[model samples]
Target chain A: MPDNLQQALGASTNEPTASSKSNLKKLPGDLAMWFFILAELTVFAIFFIGFAIAENLNLVMFAEGKAQLHKVAGLINTIALITSSYFVAISLHSMRVRNDRQAVFRLILALVFAAVYIVIKLWEYESLFEQGIDIETNTFFTLYFLITAFHFMHILLGMVILVYMAKNAYQGKYNDSSSESEFSGFESGACYWHMVDLLWIILFPLIYVI
Target chain B: MMKFWQRYALSWGWLIILTMASVAIGQYFQYATLNSVLFIAIVMLIIALKGQQIVDVFMELKHAPSLWRNIMLSYVIVVPLIITLIYI
Candidate 1:
């Protein structure tokens, strides 16, 4: 069999021999991390569906609420989060290559991008508050605040994870071995950060544009 | 073969282009007299594309185990479909 097919079959069977296991396509990060990601995505899916249902019921209110949002700020936040995800992905590549210094640098860059997201989000929230908008404003604003604030908290946690990964990379913790599992923790952290980015991509359109 | 980082950069470029396209589409729908259902469909389609890029390229799930990869990929599809259903 071709190498790619062989690897796929090995992975599917979940019974690769020791040698084949080395060549099988594997999920990045710990299995537990993937489960965690799935759980988080499920919760966000519920929130997204709820928002859509609410919008369906009150089209005028939802339209008005969306109009009040800062689309430019939403655009910038999307760019920041996507850029941060790219940096985190590159940092993982660096770690795999045992380039600890570059890994740490890229991770720090990712954190900087995330910080941009934080500042913009807080600014947007403050602007809304100044306009006398809050969760109790209406069903539209209620779901808006509930969903975005929940996501904002996730960004903060993702940043903390990035910082921890950066410190570990700088300390050469992930560069100690060629084993992929050695850096699974770093991969898990990167996955969480990307999950944050992924959620924002959908949220941007749902709340601000659509 | 493209270097991993180079591939990632290409994906990032495409993501930014898609983001710009979505914003333009959103702005156009705001003024155009087109069908709102069509607008929602286009926006959701763009969103699905963006989500897929993040899952496959940024998250490096393209070569992952089938079950996990399918689950994430399905999110990119299912959520948009649900939103489209609600909007339309």
Candidate 2:
């Protein structure tokens, strides 16, 4: 099998022979993480559909609203989130290879990149507020604030989870040899963080570009 | 023939390039042309692909069960396609 497929299979060659074989059918991360991911995605999908319909109703206003948005800031945030997601993935990969110290390091790196995203986002929001574009300004501004603010809350939550996971890793709570449930913190946190990134990928284009 | 970071780096590289491309296209349509279906269609395509990259690689859904993977893949493709058709 290809290397990425093998990694995606949650297989690291260093695992003991028994666990390596057994892990093949197991999904990465806690089962509860999948449930949360599904719920989060569903809510975002509804919001996205709602935005689409609203934009169709008021195309000119939506276009003008999008024009007021700082596309360069959105673009910068996109890169930051994407880079943070990359670090999060690598952090999880480090744990799977049983490098708990390295995992902690990578998780901190992820948090730093996520912080960059938050700073840029807040700057963008401040610019909008200075321009007198608040949530009650119009339908387009309303949806933009509602959706992006909701997504911003998720990013904050993900950061908290990452911090807790990093603490756990510091205490050596996770390793590839550990039981799946014991490793839930790392996987669950990483999954939620990625969901945030996933939502932003669509959100960026929908509100800022499209 | 590749290390793990190399594969991830490739994904990141693609993401950055596509992001810049989408922004440029967005600007072109905004300032130069109005009511262009092709521009909306192109932006929609980029959105779907970016969503796919996040689900498949960042989330590692590619190795997930077919049911899980297909569910996400459908969202990435269908949602933007619908919006594009309606708006464009």
Candidate 3:
């Protein structure tokens, strides 16, 4: 019997079943991108650990510094980044399902939320500066500016990548039928953006709240 | 079973809720009842949970190679553990 007729008749064939095919594990994105992500994560982890040690040494000063920070701003930025990540996730899903238009729209939404983060962050920095706080103010401020400014730069770079992906996606450069390498590039950019969000998840509590 | 998009939505919802919950705990419960040590531990645990969701759902690494997924998961677990130790 023909394979199609057998499939229509609900008969098993030699070919792998859908369940088995779904069980085959495959990592998303390019291998190089994963390596880059690991490197970035290691650096951020070092910075975080350093911050914790510094706080341990100057417990009072660190507590005062935390008090000065705008917790509401931090919370809002957390929400913005997480929402941005959600849009990026759905955007990638739409691309995989061949819904290019929805993918592009969702990417735009992601960019907008990311922009909210940037704007609020800059505002927070400006407010701190107005109160005579700078990287050189003290140990706490130094690490605060150092870690957050570094993450801020990553956010800018991630936005640029998102823009590139959105443009390419709108042009139908990535689709369900695209080559593996092409799809990997799109996924790689999305992963990078998510890394930024993940870093902030830890940073907000460590710096502002906890 | 949830569709892929529904799963993403669910993850997003949880991430948002966890973020807000951590903040509330840090703000309200930190002084009201819980000791400083317990408060910090709770916050660290919440941060770890948030990290896990981002890794598995947003980054789509849940079913990736075991080595890669474990590496990401370990970072989330280890970083928070280290922070908790420092505070306590």
What ranking emerges by lDDT with the best candidate at the front? 3, 1, 2
Tell me the TM-score of candidate 2's A chain.
Answer: 0.88
TM-scores, in order shown?
0.91, 0.90, 0.92
Among all windows of 10 consecutive residues in model 2 chain A, the one with the lowest summed lDDT is A1-10
lDDT of 3: 0.87
TM-scores for chain A over all candidates: 0.88, 0.88, 0.89
lDDT of 1 by residue, A1-210 (tens): 133223323433423466765466677777898899999999999999999998999989998999999999999999999999999998877775567898889988999989999999999999999999999999999899999999999999999888988888787766554533547788788889989999999999999887
In order, the B-chain TM-scores come to 0.96, 0.89, 0.93
Most DockQ-accurate candidate: 3
Q: How well is candidate 3 docked (DockQ)?
A: 0.62
DockQ for all models: 0.59, 0.59, 0.62
Number of the top-ranking candidate, with lDDT as the measure = 3
lDDT of 1 by residue, B38-58 (tens): 988998999899999999988
**Candidate 1's DockQ:** 0.59
